[model samples]
Target chain A: MRNITLSKAVNEALAEEMRLDSTVILMGEDVAEAGTPFKVTSGLVEEFGTTRVIDTPISEPGFTGLAVGAAMTGLRPVVDIMFGDFLFLIMDQLCNQAAKTHYMSGGKLTVPMVVRTNMGATRRSAAQHSQSLHALVAHIPGIKVAMPSSAYEAKGLMKTAIRDNNPVIIFEDKLMYQDKAPVPEQEYLIPFGAAHILREGSDITLVATSSMVQVAQAAALHLAEQGVSAEVIDPRTIAPLDEETILTSVKKTSRAIVIDEGHQSYGVTAEIAARIAEKAFYHLDAPVQRLGAMDVPIPFSPALEDLTVPTPDDVVARALMAMRGELFHAL
Target chain B: MAKPAQKNSDAYLHMYRQMVKIRVFEDSANELYLTAKMPGLTHMYSGQEAVAVGICEALETRDKITSTHRGHGHCVAKGANFKQMFCELLGKDEGYCHGKGGSMHIADQANGNLGANAIVGGSAGIATGAALTAKTLGTGDVAVCFFGDGALGQGLLYECMNMAALWDLPVIYACENNLYGEYTHVSEMAAGALMDRASAFGIEGHEVDGQDVLAVNELSQQLVARARNGEGPFFMLLNTYRYHGHHVGDINRAYYRSKEEETFWKETRDPITNFGDWLVTEKLASFDELQALHAEIKTEAKAAVNYALSAAYPAVEDVTEHVFAETV
Candidate 1:
């Protein structure tokens, strides 16, 4: 095993796929010349040249729609939207066209395209630049959403997404890019609906995703001082969620805490909480605790911003309260 | 320009048959819609036969075309099955899209007909992308996108043109300037000239008389050949018009267009009658031969109607069948 950053893992995955298939092409705002906005595609332009590693104008709907057309015509194009917020401008291509092409074509054609966009906040980039809207995409049926928390999962899940016949949306968080993880040197791919158990304990289960995976680990370490063992689980993919892993952990630990970076109102955290209450209700000793961003616009001030998003301390406090059933009266 | 062969006489007659086939198809579809035989909205391609036939006749079998709402002529010229096309209009199971896609969405990927879009300028990007695929895969195929003058103002069209010109993609943008963009006149809605839009993207463009099939056909042959040879994209604006309302059930006339302009276009600028007259004067076909061809088309259209009426609807259980293939 070799330790690598998330950026190098993505670079290796793309390089391997490009080597395997000659028809694969990459296009985005700065994918060719300036590398990527996040530097994920640092040296691809020099390796593949300008033809295959294409640099496109700042036309999201245009380039994204073009990727859909190219995919339908026997070429698999991987498109990178500069930021997740800009995806709103091209919703017509994504929601109306790409998502419905195969269904409307009546199985005559397949749209084998991949869209990569960066998610979450870094250094107080403020409201428009920083947002986690994975829930909005998960609402649609045709696309698969991959939210990997480590370098190993990032490379493995991307290979699976590229080989899949359907459209896939891979959301990467900015904060998770520099995290270190040991990935295998040989070729490997992670299945779409599988989850990874990071830590094993018997007291409580902490189910998190993306950047919150680190936060969950920190919370588990903090809870160890009080003699409360915590188990951490990461549902690597959000759309076809691995509910079995989360449910099994909750059943053994008899409690759960969902740490999400998105808004608290009707988001992925709510979905996971609802599923656990429906299936593993009898095994739980208390109600599920959901720790997520506050229901407000992200502030520019660092002091105000720290209070909105969930921290490791917040996760630990919520987990200890739910473990003891102290926050609720009836429970 | 390439020489029109001694077989040009027979080819001219065959071209007339294609034009009349499209004219009769649109005419019969209009009549069927009046009798409530077809569902959804219908945009008949009544007067614009020369643009579709002239352009498609110049394309090789490996070439592809993208169409718009007024797409019956392009569909016929590209050799889409008439029986399946009518079945699609009738919403039958044997339709091009298994009855899921109606008139505006009929597509046969096997025939290289990419599909007709209902959105004003949606096909531009798709056609451009297909051209990009052809270049990347080293396939010697060219793509043509047919849109009205109304689509010239869309931002996506400009984006597609700039990208195609920058990459030297094998594409031909055939703009059918039918004078009217829905109810509004093109002079009012469109800005600048058509050739200026092409030049802005560094592409060679031409303005042709769309009523003359020979002129449009000659221009298309040169342009399509240039594209196939990897000389980059071409833009041609066909000055044409529509004989009917924007769509079926649109009878209000006094709102945007005057009756005099409509009558002038109907009498003088009719592409089908112009081509038929040329075929007769040039000794390509006699009057009886042309009349017999029209009667045969009517009979063929009648059989198509019968076939569409008898075809079955798609089963309800298969709604979620083709969302994704079983394997990559």
Candidate 2:
């Protein structure tokens, strides 16, 4: 019955987990008293004290590597990388050490840790700060990747990631931090690999992830006004993807379009679209389409930046093409 | 300053045995490579046995340690036997990591050895984090990070040391200055004085003759005890050497290092021979007794190699197993 912001949902999930388990620690730059640049971890240090909600230096690799070791021990660390662009700085610790520790150790050691980061474009933060790089991490085998679509998804997913036995990476769209959505007061968890079919239709499926879920939803509404019905689905976590849900929906609809904010080249859209084409080849009327961020460094200018990521109009136009069967060209 | 403890012949004999085990293990591993039986090459820990055995002897079975690519010595010193280690080196299922990880990534968690990192100075954070866990959980446990002079080139080590100093975590950053960073001499690799790296962060620094087991052990014991008391995050510089070429296949070394330098360290400053002579002079072990112990260790190492060579390889279906701790 109550609505909360996505950032607050993340903070609440961390606070609840920290209260439930003493070993759950929060470590990051400006995470303690400053509460992070987005204030997502605000009031955590006040309640859990400095030891639990740690304030680390500007050492990305340093603290990330430390989190790997701490997780192998008794502690469950939730490490915050302020921006997803900095994930490159911690590839060795995150991909090499944390991701592979469980397998490398033959299951003798487990790194039950969460790397919380924000990714999205159109912030006008330029190439250095704004980039949705979740597809890169999802390529790695050992890590689980989560993309929360709303405040409700954020709270449930954050709790699940903290308790996971292997390394997990949760990507939140920085632009959606303050976006409010209805969430339950009681404790709940959203299991990974489960797809949420937001709205059902028979003609076509508009499957998307993270912030793009809202785009698919808006496009579905616009398509309805234009006498076209579209189904909307969100694969909450990309790593343990609910392939069955997406495939079953595509099989019923006979047409699909996968949308994500990651780069279009070798990106999340390509992977999802390829999977649909491979599995649903017999059922498809027109080829499955992909709408993702353009394959270029995110620009700084607002006008230029807005052109990179896909929009609802882009989805609607693609849907109209599928309905008209124009997507099938000479190729 | 660490005060040397009153001597007991039993302690000397135990350390002597550990050092011999490492040496014999390395020698056998080298033979495994020469015969083309092992799958991949290995970084030998032969000459630096004292540095590992000395520090590990000062630790309890519960204390944790993060080792380097050159890690067999640390593994053996931290209570790992010959069979699992040889199996791991040979990439067999009975190995410590079930054959998934070879020499460069052997991790024996049951013995509190977290794992050996292939990256230089990579385990600094892991060791420090273990110390953080000990402090947070009140476990009274300490962590040792064993790296070589090459690790001095990594900035992560400095970051971990700075944080360790800030938190007063019980961790010892032990740098075995074996005078070479892979192939480059330490003089060319390191920028300034090595001990200054610790003092810049206000961490207590200590140096020891790594060839002498008692001296290195005495200091490690003092540091480990002090760390347990919450006065740690110390730094140790163990003046040591690596006898083999960087790896087993690196035999030609006329360009980087001369044969004389290698022979000098082997003959004059060999840790095992020096310690065995000290034990004989102190009347703790007879010369005949030391020779018999050496022979016994050699036989044990050879037997382990044979077992590992005969061990089964993991099934191909199991390749996907353990990628995740559990399916979620």
Q: Work out the TM-score per prediction.
A: 0.92, 0.98
Q: What is the interface RMSD of candidate 2, in Å?
A: 1.0
Q: Write the per-residue lDDT of candidate 2 for residues B1-328, one digit (tens) a residue.
A: 1234786888889999999999889889899899999998999998898899999999999999999999999999999989998888888899999998889889988889999988888898899999999998999999999999999999999999999999999999999999888878999989989999999999999989888888899999999999999999899999999888888898997878999999999999999898888778778899999999999999898888889999999889879999888735
Runs of candidate 2 exceeding 4 Å displacement: A328-331, B1-4
Specify the highest-TM-score model's number.
2
| Candidate 1 stretches greater than 4 Å from native | A200-205, A223-231, A243-257, A273-292, A324-331, B1-7
lDDT of 2 by residue, A289-319 (tens): 9899998999999989999999999999989
Which whole-number lDDT from 0 to 100 does residue A252 have in model 2? 97
Clashing pairs in 2: none
